[model samples]
Target: MRVHKLTFAALAVAASLPLAACQSSGGGKGQSDPSSAAASTAPSPSDSKASDAKSPAGQGTAAATGSPANGKVDKCRTDELEITAKDNTIDGDPDGTVAVQLKNRGSRDCTMSGYAGVDLKTNSGPVSAKRSGEQAGPAVLKPGKSVAFGINYPVNNSGGSGVRITGLLVTPPDETKSVTLDWPGAATLPVTESPGTPVKVGPIGSAGQGG
Candidate 1:
């Protein structure tokens, strides 16, 4: 009887061994989930930084295209002049001061004289205003290069309604090769003189306030 009992005990112990091995091999309740483990490791700082950099605010497109200091003229057609207006400030009068930036993204350099000043068109006709700087061109802007024209005027009598800059004329110094610049529309920027203000207008040719 004793010998038979000992053999039975050994057989029971052997059966339990397989159960232990199965549990160790992920067949048990405490088995690890691979995906959850990876998430817990956390992402690196570099990865987080890259995501933030792609944001629009970081790229400086919060309002318009191009640099914040300058206004960008969009969709300039071939053979037509392009002007982008920026930094508009209207004081007590509707007509204040503004900076008109011009660019010659064309193949050939734009050699012109007497570029047209900004005009406020109304029902009667085009209301002509004077810019402090010279319209005289020959301001030779190479391909992809840009030049700015500083203009200051009273916001008063700027057409009781909306106004368009209309067009620009490029009269070359050598010959009368004139190029008509089509207006892409107008951008109304707030007028402010404070350091933190978006639009600032000061003296001409004072390190960026140039025409």
Candidate 2:
């Protein structure tokens, strides 16, 4: 009887050893590694984005859109401006300058940069003017204030018969709308009958400054 009991006790001890080995391997599996857990919850650089800022020192919407970050003015629009051509003599043109004046007729201050779109309306359709001059700086137009640009035409200096301009079509910078003004008799452009476009215009500048 004693020998049989000893054999059963030895078998039971061996069986318990395997169960403890299995438990040791599985015990820590339920817990996650601290390093891996931190990585999963952290934000990645690609997921980050910049929010819209106001502008000025190269930060906001103004810098992106080429406007001053001041946010106080906007590009001058067509409906709020009054355009008129002046004879070289009327506005004191420097020798052979053709100038047109643009006045801010709106109640708010307006701003403009770069070139104004210019076209010479004639009996032979429209003649688009080429842009010239150094890059223009921004011009802020106060209520009732004015600005101007010049037209440099390939004048028929040979004094031959040339194309006649009937009117003017002018558009403010960065605007699609346009305004038509009567071609001033003093602001005459006598282009040659040459094939290539010989007309050029200048950037928005002080009236009568050759743009």
Candidate 3:
């Protein structure tokens, strides 16, 4: 009977050992799952620093390109310009050209563009002058610099009507007042009795050899 009691006690202790081992393994698995979840939720330090570095460079580039709100400049004034005419008469040609030079006499920079209004004047009244149909772009004139234009017309070779031109009446672009430049040397301008006659005037360009 004692031997049977010892055998029963050993069986009970052996079953209890497996149950204790199972409880220990379950607690270990639960702790390992929570540790893995914490590692996945945390943010990386390297990724946060890289995002901060790129923001300032983009903002700096935008500020550099956007200065100067208004884009247009001021127009040129007439009183600041000095006007003169140069004789460019070629030999044996009926068509002649007079180069009109305009110098910027002001202290500041200005702009000049388009055709200059020109007319020939005699003792009686103004003669007819046609525009040369030359297109001009805007030209920026620095202080003391000059720009030129050409006045083209026919020479008076006919002996029928003796018309004399004493001076030139020049009007700058977008100006109300006119400037009168005297005829250089013995230069004579062609004259016609008809009204509204055309005188060819070229666009503003670089200063030529004469005037």
Candidate 4:
């Protein structure tokens, strides 16, 4: 009877040891590591795309406008001149002279005239040319009036190869406000042969925003 009782006690003790080991193992897994838990719940790549799609277009445009020198386009009075270049005047070679047109889009008749300067800058310094032109149209632009000015960059003295176009400084009569037709910008003027290069000239690069 005593031997049977001892054997039953030994088995019970062995069973309790396993339960104790299991309880200790459960405590080790009480909580997952914070870093791993966060990773599991993190947003997938597709979620980022979905978030971007919900963003407003105006926000993107605003970012673009502010990107260059905290860039803000100053509206000068009634007329706004839009300047476009034939080529980027950089990277690729220009077949001919880059043409720039100034149009007056305002309620009142406005004059667009100034010393259109082209400064081809290099590592050393800027090589500049000045050519001035004026509009022959009426003094007051009746809602829509346009004027065109073409500047032919001299190939012989252009100096550098990699080039960028700056902008036109448009000065009105009163000169209350000068409009800067800021362009795509400065680059090294490619070296090329001049066939019948018309003499071109303009003001040196001015630090002011206006003409």
Candidate 5:
């Protein structure tokens, strides 16, 4: 009976050794590979931080480009300019012209471009003159600089039987306010009308170049 019991114990121990060896070999081949573990969990905290840091910096750069102060100049104001008027009529030409000038009285440079608004006052009402001739480019008026424009109008020839001149309301180019000045046209021949005569205004330019 003792020899039988020793033989059964020997068989059980031999069978259990092969099963333990198979489990160890399976663990090594399936899940315990160092290359697989490293590839699956390779993303470090530094990798996430490096990608996340660029977003805020890119947004800050985009916000800085939207600002609008790139050193552009502004238009001239009426209060900063002193206006004057004089007759500049040519004798040979049928039409007569009055030169309206604007001098910058301010301390800094300002832009004056386009036509001046002119209205001739009569006993009936104000006659708005239409703009004529070529448009001048933007003229930068420095401190104490002056620019002039012309108001070419019809002349009275039939013994003062047309519109009598009183005063003129002149608005500078791109300005809101206006100044009142005496009529600079001839007093002898006030502004008269022929069959197809119209009052014309010129662009703002240097001195006599306005017409």
Candidate 6:
């Protein structure tokens, strides 16, 4: 009876050893590795720095894309303007004067600076005018607004004995084509047979009534 009890006791001890081994292996699996756990929980230094850097760069790019306040405006075209002239003569002086008006007929605003080109025209040919030494203020013409300049010349009985001016050819600054304005009346610009330097043109101004 004693020998049989010893064999049973040994078999019980062997079964307990296998259970202990299994418990030890399962204990390691329950706790996670320290390095792997930290990697999963926190972002890397490089990744954090990259995220911070991208934010301000994106903001700066957005700011640069906005439009500027003082942008450049476009120049005036010939088809967008209207030209008119009137005789501005003095009673006693033989020096004749014509006030030329430039109206902006288009939809937008335009800039005009410096002197306009002027010439006296007849059936024979064109006589060029000299630019005066005077400088006028810049003109910004909105729609339907107008500017003016002056053209001064001698009358028929003056130094130009036979000079006759049938028409006036006016070219705006920075324009290729010119507009022709007929003489308002015979008294406005007296017809002379002899022609010299028939005219001298002045700078442009905002007030059309004065030079």
Query: Which lDDT value does model 6 have at 176?
Result: 86
Q: Measured by TM-score, how close is model 6 to the native structure?
A: 0.60
**Candidate 4 minimal-lDDT segment of 10 residues:** 202-211
**Predictions ranked by lDDT, top down?**
5, 6, 3, 2, 1, 4
- Tens-place lDDT per residue, model 2, 1-211, is 9999999999999999999999988987977989999999987765543222222435554457885566677788888988888755334433354688888899999888889889888777798988876577888888888888887664434565566778889888899998898876433356555675666778888453222
**Every model: Cα RMSD to truth:** 19.8, 12.2, 10.8, 19.5, 8.3, 6.3
Per TM-score, the best of the predicted structures is: 5
Candidate lDDT scores, in order, read 0.48, 0.74, 0.75, 0.47, 0.81, 0.77
lDDT of 1 at 161: 47
lDDT for each residue of candidate 3 in 131-160, tens digit (9 for 90 to 100): 667666877878888888887776676754
lDDT of 4 at 14: 93
lDDT of 1 by residue, 103-189 (tens): 666876545444343454333344444434433424556677665655554332434443334453433223334455443334332
Which pairs of residues have clashing backbones in candidate 3? 129-198, 129-199, 130-198, 130-199, 130-200, 132-201
lDDT by residue (tens digit), candidate 4, 1-211: 9999999999999999999999989987996889988889999889977877768666888898877674333332423554443332333444234444444555444443344444433444444444544333222333354443444453433554544434544443333554555443333345435443232432211111121
Give the C-alpha miss distance for residue 134 in model 6, angstroms.
0.5
- Total backbone clashes of model 5? 0
CA displacement after TM-score superposition, residue 176 of candidate 1 (Å): 9.6
- The better candidate by lDDT, 2 or 3, is 3
User: Compared with the true structure, what per-residue lDDT tens digits does model 6 show for residues 134-160?
Assistant: 877677888888888888876665343
lDDT of 4: 0.47
The predicted structure with the larger lDDT, 1 or 2, is 2
Q: Give one clash count per candidate, in the order shown.
A: 11, 1, 6, 14, 0, 6
Residue-level lDDT of model 5, residues 152-198, one tens digit each, is: 88777767557777888999877779999999795533544454336
